[model samples]
Target: MAKRELTPEEKARNGRNIALALGLIAFVVIVFITTIVRLGGNVVQRTF
Candidate 1:
């Protein structure tokens, strides 16, 4: 089967989707790092 090319709208949508995904991933990573830093090395010794 022959491959088809993407329309301009499809390209734009793909770009936007990629940007949103990257932004979300970055946000999650930042939050995770912040949580780890806030917890620190003593996290293991702390009682729940």
Candidate 2:
């Protein structure tokens, strides 16, 4: 089967979607890291 070529508009939309997904992933990772760092000290010295 022959591969289909994407039109310019479709390509642009695809690129934008990929960028948006990556940005969301990065934001989530940053938030997770920040939360972990903020709580890391407390976690080590808990009594219970």
Candidate 3:
């Protein structure tokens, strides 16, 4: 079996898609971290 090769345009599109996916993942991680911090602060306040 032979592997398929991508044209220049297709490669460019793939690069763009990868960047977009990474950006979205970063945004989600930031939101999750923020939620955890807020939850932790609330727990600390209650303990004191």
Candidate 4:
């Protein structure tokens, strides 16, 4: 099957969608790392 060329508007929309997806993924990863770091110190309890 032959692929058709994307118009300027379609190309722009596709680029915006890709950027949004990547930005969302990055935000999630940052939040996850922050949570892990913040909670990591208290995870292990010391016995007296």
> What is the C-alpha lDDT profile of model 4 across 1-48, one tens digit per residue?
899999999999999999999999999999999998998867676455
Q: Rank the candidates by TM-score, best first.
A: 2, 1, 4, 3
* Residue 11 shift from truth in candidate 1, angstroms: 0.2
Q: What is the alpha-carbon lDDT for the whole of candidate 2?
A: 0.97
Better of 2 and 3 by lDDT: 2
Task: Give per-model CA RMSD.
Answer: 1.3, 0.9, 2.9, 2.8
The sequence of per-residue lDDT tens digits that candidate 2 reaches over residues 1-48 is 998999999999999999999999999999999999999989899899
Assess each prediction's global lDDT (C-alpha) against the native: 0.96, 0.97, 0.93, 0.93
Pairs that collide in candidate 2 are none
Q: What would you estimate as the lDDT of candidate 1?
A: 0.96
TM-score of 4: 0.84
User: What digit string (tens of lDDT, one per residue) describes model 3 on residues 10-43?
Assistant: 9999999999999999999999999998798686
Off by over 4 Å in 1: none
Q: Of the candidates shown, which would achieve the greatest TM-score relative to the real structure?
A: 2
Q: What's the lDDT for residue 22 in model 3?
A: 100
